[model samples]
Target: MSHSTLKASVIISIYQDVEALHAILYALSRQIEQRFEVIIAEDCECKAVREYLAQHTFPFAINHLTQEDKGFRKTKAVNRAVAAAKTEYLMFLDGDCLPHSQYVAEHLNQRENNRVCTGRRVHLGPTMSRWFRKKPSLIKLIENRLVYTLLGLPLVFDHTKNYEIGFRSTTLHKRQAKKYLTIVGCNWSVSRADMLKINGYNEDLPGVGGEDDDLGWRFNGKGIHEKSVKFVIPVYHLHHVERRADVSTNLQIIKQNTAQKRYYCKNGVDKYLSETHEKLKSNA
Candidate 1:
């Protein structure tokens, strides 16, 4: 990679999880020799998260922003954040996620033409065994669905092991790219150009559930394959409070898009970004 390519940016979508945001920021600060800008898009209606990020000194300069008063869906906040990114490469990490030290370097190394790279997610809270012993209600499921149109899986009966089934590693390597059925927006990296092509994520996604799946569908349709980085770079998912369902219809949208390959094609996000340079200027 050239010096130009080394210029990358990290984009994170945040709502009200101050604790998770702090953890993510600390993990990112440990990277000793890299230079990249981190943009945090606070989608929540509150100012607490913004205040916290402002008070801290991160390893890299941090750009913090907020959207107009809107509900807590992640898509709007993230899009606003990406529009402000100042790098050739864009890495999306969830506020609740703890990336390994080599996370950014690993993704930068794996980047290739028309490709989106995603890594594995490991649960970081009490063992699955413990979860079953203290089975919590599906409060999270309901909140996620009703509040954000997102979905959370039922607690596994066994907690001794990681929730391996929830997040299986991708097997693809850097050189070869192939279409994928889905890509997790969190812990995934793609050129800012590629993202805008799919309209910077379906703002009309109806909820939080299928935004990633929708992006995967759009990429596959556009011939942009998904590559897994799990065998190499792994992320720890800090256990947190379950979310209430704000909406559940978006999952169905993803299912339909995946089945139909709704946005699969050759020309995609790259073209979109190029055309909308003025609109998404910051990310470029």
Candidate 2:
């Protein structure tokens, strides 16, 4: 399909980071390919985010799907967003992470059937995060990678060696081995049909943890392969306090799901899919 016709629903999971959220939305507005919708999967009903969305205007269609502020319900928020998505493809991102100008374009260009694309992000320090929050000139940093390298800021560059944008970088590679272990939820993409086949994310595993890996494992069990877009679709993750308290519990759930080779979760996107459809019908 041509770039113009290729539509994707970009789902961003957010939990109260207004500064970073604004920066991400601004960066997304400047994407090289402006053919995708933005869905804010808010874990809580953040008034600040609501105010910002109501005030600002964006080029693409933007929707907000928020739940109550109930601890860490990232999985539930994302599943709801997926149900409301109205595109052929879906791209997952965190609200704090600013995308490169070519991030969406690269992912859409490298999309394939029965495969999931996994990308990496650069963790910026507090200083750079603050600066970007003030200015939000993401295109400048992305276009001029050498400046960031020369400055040698205290940033953790995760698999960003292949940050160039070209036909060569857009080439998709298959991961025949270890496909399930490396799937990061923050920067990932999958077809809507494939996502439904596995029934979307597992809501049972909650509180900021291994729900992503469990989704990947289930996909792999269903004959789907993982594609690495590591350096090709790099984003800049803003610095923030970590919120992982149930790591062990989440990991144990993933381990059990993997050992059983379960391809579908009992509580997942199916729960909200019908409700979303009904609401849309009512609105119409």
Worst 10 residues of 2 by lDDT: 159-168
RMSD of each: 9.4, 3.9
Per-candidate TM-scores read 0.71, 0.88
What is candidate 1's lDDT per residue for 1-284, written digit by digit as tens? Answer: 23354567888877777766776776677654377888887776557786776677765778777667666457767776666667778898887666666778878888987988876665644553233224322222222323312222433432312444233234433332343325775689998877766656666565556667677777767777787665456565656566535346777766766677667423222343353476656666
Indicate the residue-level lDDT of 218 in model 2. Answer: 90
| Candidate 1 Cα lDDT to native | 0.63
**Model 2 agreement with the true structure over 1-284: per-residue lDDT tens digits:** 34356489999999888888888888898899998899999999989989988999998888898999879888899999999888889999988888888888888987999999887776666766778898898447545657666555234343232233211233433332233326787788989999999999888886577777788779988988888776577787777777778888989888887788779888899989889889989999
* Stretches > 4 Å off in candidate 2: 1-6, 153-181
The model with the greatest lDDT is 2
